[model samples]
Target chain A: MASRAAVKTVIMVAAVALAAATGLAGAGARAADADAVRRGEYLFNAAGCLGCHTDEKGGGKPLAGGRALATPFGTFYPPNITPDPEHGIGRWSDADFIRAFREGRAPDGSYLYPAFPYPSYTRMTDRDLLDLKAYLFSREPVAAANRPHDLSMPFSWRFLLAGWQWLYFDTRGPRPDDPAKPPEWNRGRYVVDALGHCGECHTPRTTFGGMEADRYLAGNPKGPNGDKVPNITPQPRFGIGGWTPGDITLLLETGLTPEGDVVGNAMAEVVRNSTSKLTADDRAAVAAYLQSLPPIGPPP
Target chain B: MDSRVVNALAAGSVAAFLYLGFGGLGAAATDGDPAALVKQREQTMKSMGGGLQTIAKFVKGEAGSAADVQAAVAAITEASSKDPAVVFPQGTAIGTADSDAKPELWQNWPKAVEYWNGLKPATAKLTEAANAGDRAQIAQALQGVSKACANCHEDFRQKKQ
Candidate 1:
């Protein structure tokens, strides 16, 4: 009888220990998920998702898009990215989300417009993209419907985007770290090129709207809102070679130039929303990355 | 009368008439040529920028004295205290080679006035801090002034292309 009692006690102890182990594992998973969301929030700001996704001027809900992006082609109203089942991206699976950034293809197998900036986003690592998705999914979903793009004629034809993508899209996976460079430099490149997507505006575009690969960050004569985006290359005359890393960091922090003048317009918005939100280390990294670039002069 | 004399008189009368019509309008607007007013306002803004630069130098410990900081504060205050309507008159909103003022400044006149008026309080705080000779306060106040400059420029000034 005592042996049977001992066996029952052993079974109860085993069950209790299993329950405890399971509970600990669940807590660990929750903590990891939280960390991912936090990291994703940082990436969201760096990627400038909020500025384009939300219509702050129109008093629309955050991530419930209605922002009008005026381009040479036509006005593009960014769709709602919030997690509402009816209107937003609530029903998107992990593969759907990944494919959206990686292939610039929607869950419905339709090609997304370049106006969504998936070309730059395509360079982001899978882990970073997943983390960003986690953060986005954690947000409060709104029932606001996505607005249709106001493109004219052939531009409105979604199928035609396949041709454009075929011509411009690199279809390459995440950018790999250069073994030759320091970790900081690699981080800077990832942030500036992939997450920040500075080239989308700073780099001049071809007649086909593809970024001119030869003249990266040289400057855009016709940028969004008809503003002439300045060259950020390290050129002494035309670019920011004269600026020290501290000057760049200060500009990112407060929009104040070394000349004591504050930046204005679209850049001002970038300063306020994106760069300002970055950690000091990240800002310094951006400075280092920019300072290291080959100095490209203005187009002759 | 000789044709030469008639031509001279006619030219003189036309010059007088043109001066009276346009000059009266200019006088009614801001008591001087609009271009000259733009130039003056530009100079005032430059002076403010120079003053801020001086303060920045002092903050960085690169150069300048406490007295210099006070002087810079004074200059910024004086420049910012000017009546916006007088300095930023309607005719000066055109984008010329000399003027950086955007047409939106006049389009949203009330908001422009508000931003211009905001500079006064910001500069006044800087003046107070500079007079105190507290470096930290002065730096903080300088941020306020910079923000005020940015607020106005964000909407009114044409960005460098």
Candidate 2:
């Protein structure tokens, strides 16, 4: 091993260089970066962003993409989300970031497919988006090249997404909320129901791409990785309605379920990336908000 | 955790892999060379011993608890069955883990006759424990049996990823 002094010297140099580059960059200065970074990291995993976007678990490098996300239409290669300007999201401006997430548009005004889960992200508030953007910008830029989606013809066309979005997508802002809910609870609801979009997997989907909001999280048998995503709603049978907030919290902190089982799949990646590191309070808030949803069964 | 199921799966998969991937592994112990096959059996026994020893160390003192007993028992039974010829040596009693085999059992092989003589008693002991239905006794017996299995793993088996 290198001497301790050598390691310290390298760390100090890197820290100083980072200070020089991002020291007074005003974007992240609105709030201390640490909180936003923490929240972004949590939401990213909660959103299952890396689970599909990165083939990190099975001997692949983290966030250096190339996982094939299979949809009925075809398989789409989730891009490397590293901060690399050429191939990743490094150069995205705040508006560009918001638009990509909230509007499903790329930096160059191209529309990204809902497969990126922008449908869930669209519910995100401006602050949450900024925080997520802040976290993404703070990361190391990995220079892995991109791969084109192996989509079949017609579905591969970029313009087709525009018409598809018109039918299945909702570009409208999240509904104005009750003032009674505490700010953090509201924030949790926003992230879970919207930007974080836990329901995309937990909730059943319509034959078209839209979610079955009426049923809300009874369970989605068809998950992004093809594993069954169980219900988080208050249904005692097919859902987590039986789980206490602590049960959910433990599940988030560790890959192990309350039943003393740990599964290997998309969820394992999600736990490794996001939820495991979340602050107790944030995870609790998410649990509280989810449990409060109307107790319901999966879509018939 | 349903460690019983996991143990079955682990042992079954290994047996299956050896059977499917290559013919040599699942074949009868008598099929291979006289000396090399004996050495290979010894190696597997040693590795099993080491694995048991490590877990035994963890479960023995402050770290040991009621939770691990069932798992330990299942693991020991699984290992003992897979290679009883090497795992069980001569001169042991029924329902006992090791049954007082020669102290240098690791150093010597008492041949197929001695091997069957040693393992028959241990297997019988395991059968008794299984039938007793006393959870605590079962667990205690398992720990004892597993201690012997660990020694085998340490000496005889190859490490799998």
- Per-model interface RMSD values are 1.8, 13.2
- After superposing candidate 2 on the true structure, give the runs of residues whose Cα lies further than 4 Å from its correct spot: A1-48, A58-61, A174-177, A182-184, B1-161
Query: Which residues of candidate 1, in runs, are more than 4 Å off?
Result: A1-19, B1-30, B55-70, B117-144
Compose the digit string of candidate 1's lDDT tens values, residues A94-173: 89999999999999999999988888999998999999999999999999988899998788898998999989888896
Docking class of predicted structure 1: acceptable
Q: Write the per-residue lDDT of candidate 2 for residues A22-43, one digit (tens) a residue.
A: 8667545656788888777766
Clashes (candidate 2): 29
**What C-alpha lDDT do the candidate models reach, one value each?**
0.87, 0.62
lDDT (10s digit) by residue, model 2, range B1-161? 69999999999999998787677643545344344444544454454344343333333232434344334445544544565444443332222332323334444454433443443355446446545545445435433343333333222322211
Model 1 quality (TM-score): 0.85
Specify the poorest-scoring 10-residue window by lDDT in model 2 chain A. A255-264
State the lDDT at A167 in candidate 1. 92
